[model samples]
Target chain A: MNGDAYWLGVASGFVVVGVVIEMVRRRYLRGRFALVWILLGVGAILLALFPRLLERAATALGVTVPLNLLLFLGSIAMLIMIMQLSAEAGRLRERTRVLAEEVALLRTLVGSADEPRARSIAAEDRDQDSPR
Target chain B: MGTRGRGKVLVVVPAYNEAEAIAGVVASVTRAVPTADILVVDDGSCDATSAVARAAGARVATLPFNLGVGGAMRTGFRHAKREGYSAVVQVDGDGQHDPAFIPQLLAALEHHDVAVGARFAGTGDYVVRGPRRWAMRGLASGMSALMTTRLDDATSGFRACGPRAISVYAQHYPAEYLGDTLETLVIARKSGLTVTQVPVAMRHRNTGRPSHGSARSSVELLRAGCVVMLGLVREWPVIADSSP
Candidate 1:
């Protein structure tokens, strides 16, 4: 109903999204992220009902719209994702180099197996024992 | 091309059913450099490969069974090392690689660790063919670029090895692997030994098409690719000199 209350609901939404993203990235706040999301969703509903908390929080925080808060939180989450992905890519590259070397070594083994060395002693005996 | 020089250089020819061309190949090498002793690794050929090579003045080391190209070459390299040759050049028995060019490779070996014959290097190529052949040559060019070393004929079995390479190659050559020849280069580099290729012309195979098998198991091509890539990752060559 009131602009203040509507903006308050938006602020709640921002804090919740930010916390959720942070928790997911860190992999530490599994239950807390869920709890926060629910609490913010409920707060959003309450703001719609009361229509006054928005005015209070907006005036308190000196912010204008509720949407900006949500955008800011998502941006932080994205930064975290990018950092993690880069690390993963680096690990995969190291693994690829390792596999390439292995393939090279195996190929070498197959090529050398044919080189003549020695025969079994029993075969030598067989040749010696044979009648001329 | 193992240039840790002292004794005479020995050239190893691994021939299978190459009876027809053995004499010519041997004659060329002997004529070019009379003192260079040649050994032929006759890989259980039913044909007269050994006799012809022997007739041409090459001592034959017969393998009771056919041990493929890598095996034949390794045996020859081993014999060279055991007999105490100053260096060894692995020449094919089929007459594809030139014996006349042996001196050129030897010349390169004076400064470089290895001398490789490039089939497409300059103005030659009477016989290396097919889409697969072109593809292999292209891959080698790219691999050389990647390794930061210019290797035009990275897959050539036509090579000259010195004492350093012989000592390492004699131990483990992956003789069963078709592409083990290329891997030896990678191994040499990894072991911190210098392996540089010299430009030499490659001619056509005098006899027999050494089967590509299937497009799937194109042994020669696959091993070529594998060796170059492995060079980057391996800590060093499988040189026994590294161990404590």
Candidate 2:
């Protein structure tokens, strides 16, 4: 890569690393997700700083083109991230369903205990709603 | 709160938008099992199912959103566990299940932890056809082998669960389609609870339509296969190891 392109890659990598760290610090992003992204950003910086390392990795992986190697690794990383997100979403949905069920059961318990009081309050509300 | 003559058994009716027939269902269940406390679990119905069931003299638990029958039954089972009930009988809210057979189901529970009201056990004229029938037979045979007993209708909604089955279901009932019936039986068997079946007569639904259409019956078969496979492969909690 040319000097300007190399600097651009390194700068973008630093930006990505900084933004993710800030997000984690502000509690906007969970540490588990942030860890993957931070590592990705650091890898990008390393590859940009030492282009020879990328060439060697591409050769070791039996890829003739270094850019193709980068693209393949990036694709795999995205796929893994997406799968992790799907798994997290499923867990969240299950948790939400459990919470909703618990709420329904609790409401039933409270409603039964407060039935008489609730009836009188309902009666008062109906009385207030009626035209004078 | 009114446990006047309420026995240890609770009848849990999982209802979803069955306002038209809920009152009648509740009434019939009450008439059949006067000593058993009736609980209507309103599965986020858009209609007045909860009010109708309450008016018909059954305690109602209204979910905030629809979580299907599995979620509703789990709520019922958990409530039964918390309230110290010894057993739970599931009666469908659509009035298809005859509450008169509830006594027979409960009686079966005397010898087993789970008693299923089997439709094809030669009592009911309830006939299923085509792919749905074949799928049900496949499930029944599979469950029979697993439980080491004959279960004519493994997907029967009408069932009575003793304390052990109640505990197992309260914690691990799957909210997926067919899970409330098929997977629940699998869970019961996996938990080392003995299961048995009693012949019961089923009636036509007073309201609402049947869940499976001819076109969808094939899809339902595929879904049932997935559910059974998942239930068998998934790790389950052993009742023997769990804290009492």
Q: In every candidate, what fraction of the native interface contacts is reproduced? A: 0.00, 0.69
Give the runs in model 1 whose Cα sits over 4 Å from its true position.
A1-132, B1-6, B127-130, B213-223, B227-244
What would the TM-score be for candidate 2 when compared with the true structure?
A: 0.88
**TM-score of each model's B chain?**
0.84, 0.93
Candidate that would win on DockQ: 2
- For model 1, residues A29-128, the per-residue Cα lDDT tens digits are 5664456555655665565556556556665777687555546655786676678668878777545433333332233234434323222322353356
Candidates in order have lDDT scores of 0.65, 0.85
Candidate 2 residue runs with Cα over 4 Å from true position? A112-132, B1-7, B240-244
Q: How badly does each model clash, as a count of residue pairs?
A: 27, 0
RMSD of each: 15.2, 5.7
Question: Judged by lDDT, which candidate is best?
Answer: 2
